[model samples]
Target: MTFFRAFCIERSAPATREALCGRFLSLDETALDAGDVLIRVECSSVNFKDALAATGRGKVVRRFPCVGGIDLAGTVLRSAAPRFAPGEKVIATGYELGVAHHGGYAERALLPGGWLLPLPASLSSQESMAIGTAGLTAAMAITRMEENGLKPERGPVLVTGASGGVGTLAIDMLAGRGYEVVALTAKAEQADWLRGLGASRVMLRSELPLDAFKPLDKGIWAGVIDNLGGATLAWALSTSKPTGVVASIGLAADSHLSASMMPFVLRGVSLLGIDSVYAGFSVRERAWARLAADLRPRHLASIMRIIPFEALPQVFGEFIAARATGRTVVQIARSGETEDMT
Candidate 1:
């Protein structure tokens, strides 16, 4: 019967254009949505989507007074679900979290039994939050690419927006899989850091421009994991080698793609849309398994910044401005300790 503090956004009027005023409030367990498992949230990571939801910029928040964190890693405090028990470690991301449902910004969370995944043996709760939804999206993109015949022997793989969380993880995971990875970043200062994260080469976004609406360009990449979805994705599609697959994960840029169909019709290129939120449980389990095994980033800790929960508002602003790099994890509870739910 313990109460906790949480951040909430309340919108008074529903208009096509509206503003959200967020504040910290006290909440009890009864305030959380009904669920079979109660988790004492240890860490919750900040993602670009979380930023959008927090700011009310991109229709990410469907309801008022909602908590906004898409990814949470914690210890189970109580569970009616047979798969999970008290003291078990778990992580939850995607599947309507931080959107239509109340999310993980609080010290506590009540999530559906099926939405919870047992923490992988190799990852700690902090490490899992560091990976978060951004890392999972990267893993899903890589898994999709591999399933579509991407191989280390083919040629170089390109990761667009390579300094962001998903982009950084994609670079690390692809390089870990033995692919020669080329990182494309808008920030020139992060070139050395990207290189240290196993990137074979780093290029500025200005260096790779889509000057013309050409149907196709010189074939360079064996595959591409594109987080920037505007002209950058269009250029990747036009320039990828024949039979190459391009996985579109995020839309940091504009979502609309204005390009010719000649790349697909003439070059046999494939554009794969990656939606991590609605992915099936089996698929998510396999993705997490792969992340625990082959896809875990070697220098994962280097890219993570741990912050207190109170700093989330400012962090959200930085994320929305595209200034924050790597993973921003919010520490809600002490490490290796389970809360009493009973």
Candidate 2:
């Protein structure tokens, strides 16, 4: 049995609900809920969901006093499962973590063995967290596009919200795989960064007129990875080439889509909904393997901002406010040493 320091939220007074505070507390191994594996959490990353959960918004937490982090990477300390063993580095994301269960905010975590994947040989623990759920989702989007016949010989591919983690990685991976990548972002200042990540072209979100609800428009892109749904998705659907596909991974803008279905019926456009939470293990493994292989972006480390655990709350606020860019990783343990928090 071992004990470690962890962050805990304490709601002192009912009137001070807005002032709910987080403090470091000493936690014992026995405090962890039942699971087949015990991991020492070395690093965790902030996603939009994590930010929402940390800020007490979006109904992200179903229960109080929960450790809030949806993605974590570390080393296995102990495992009763046949597939993993002690001293192996691993990653855990999605599947009720950080929401219905205590998650990666702690220095240690206990998780069902089925929820963990062996850390890919091509990625370090830090790199894995840097990729996190965003990178994984990006890879899944590309895989879906390819599965839906998004060929390199086809015309250009468009990535909406290209300044974000998923969008940036999608651009890098798509371009890396020999497709002409068009980055769509609201941040004009990040154009150089997006170009550096292999985007062939960059367009501002303001340039796209979403209010025009035309049945169909000029067929521009061969395919699209749309992280911002709502108007962007509707616009993408309306403007996509014949037989083009759009993988809808997020609703950062809004969930509702007010558009005609003529594109779907006439142009053979397919809108695929993507969810990381319920992805099958085979699909998860394939995505991670591809991320380790061709989809691994060369500029991944450059886009990441590393901060200590103490700074998680403030950084999360910035993420929720749309002020944070690229990927933000929380360093929970000493450098280079994998912490098992299972």
Scored by lDDT, the top model is: 1
lDDT of 2 by residue, 132-248 (tens): 999989889889989999998989999998888888888888889999999999999999999999999999999988777577999998999998888899999999999999999
Q: In model 2, where do residues sit more than 4 Å from their true spots?
A: 9-23, 335-342
Task: List, residue by residue over 172-220, the lDDT tens digit for candidate 1.
Answer: 9988889999999999999999999989999899877667746788889
Tell me the TM-score of model 1: 0.95
Location of the lowest summed lDDT over 10 successive residues in candidate 2: 11-20
Model 1 misplaced stretches (Cα beyond 4 Å): 12-20, 334-338
Give the deviation of candidate 2 from the true structure as CA RMSD: 2.5
RMSD of each: 2.3, 2.5
Deviation in Å, model 2, residue 8 alpha carbon: 3.4
Best candidate, TM-score: 1
After the best TM-score superposition of candidate 1, give how far the Cα of residue 327 lies from its true spot, in angstroms.
Answer: 0.6
